[model samples]
Target: MQDREGIGKIMTETGKIVTETGKILTKTCKIMTETGKIMSKTCNIMTETCKIVTETGKIVTETGKVMTKTCKALTEKCKIIKETGKKMTETCKIAKE
Candidate 1:
């Protein structure tokens, strides 16, 4: 009887160990799934961010071109105004004489 009880106890302990191992494996599998999901989300975010940065760069380039053209136009207008002012002064001086 004593030997039988010892054998039964060992079998029960072995079953418990197997159950605990199975639970640990299930938990590890869940953790791996969650980690994969997080990695996928991070990659998506990075891809979107790169696209935004590329679009912003294009906008900045276009804006720079527009600003350069506007600056050149203003410079030409200022030169014209200065020349007109000088001509008007010359005309006034001649009339005064």
Candidate 2:
């Protein structure tokens, strides 16, 4: 009878260990799935950021070219205004004399 009781205790202990191990495995699988989802989201965000950066760079380059052209046009206009003002002063002086 004592031997049978010992055997039953051993079986009960082994069954508990198996149950705990199964629970641990289920938890580990859940964690792995969550980690995979997080990695996928991070990859998507990085891809979008890269596309935005490329578009912004292109816009900056275009704006620089436009500013350069605008500056050159303004400089030419200033030169024309100075020449016209000088001619107007000369004409007024001749008329007063």
Give all candidates' CA lDDT scores.
1.00, 1.00
Candidate 1 Cα misplacement greater than 4 A, ranges? 1-15
Q: Residue 69 lDDT in model 2?
A: 100
- lDDT per residue as tens, model 2, 1-97: 9999999999999999999999999999999999999999999999999999999999999999999999999999999999999999999999999
Q: What global local distance difference test value does model 2 have?
A: 1.00
Q: Candidate 1: lDDT over CA atoms? A: 1.00
lDDT of 1 at 94: 100
Tens digits of per-residue lDDT, candidate 1, 1-97, equal 9999999999999999999999999999999999999999999999999999999999999999999999999999999999999999999999999
| lDDT, residue 17, model 2 | 100
Provide the lowest-lDDT 10-residue window in model 1.
86-95
Please tell me which predicted candidate would have the highest TM-score against the true structure.
Answer: 1
The alpha-carbon lDDT assigned to residue 8 of candidate 1 equals 100
Q: Where's the lowest-lDDT run of ten residues in candidate 2?
A: 80-89
| TM-score of predicted structure 2 | 0.68
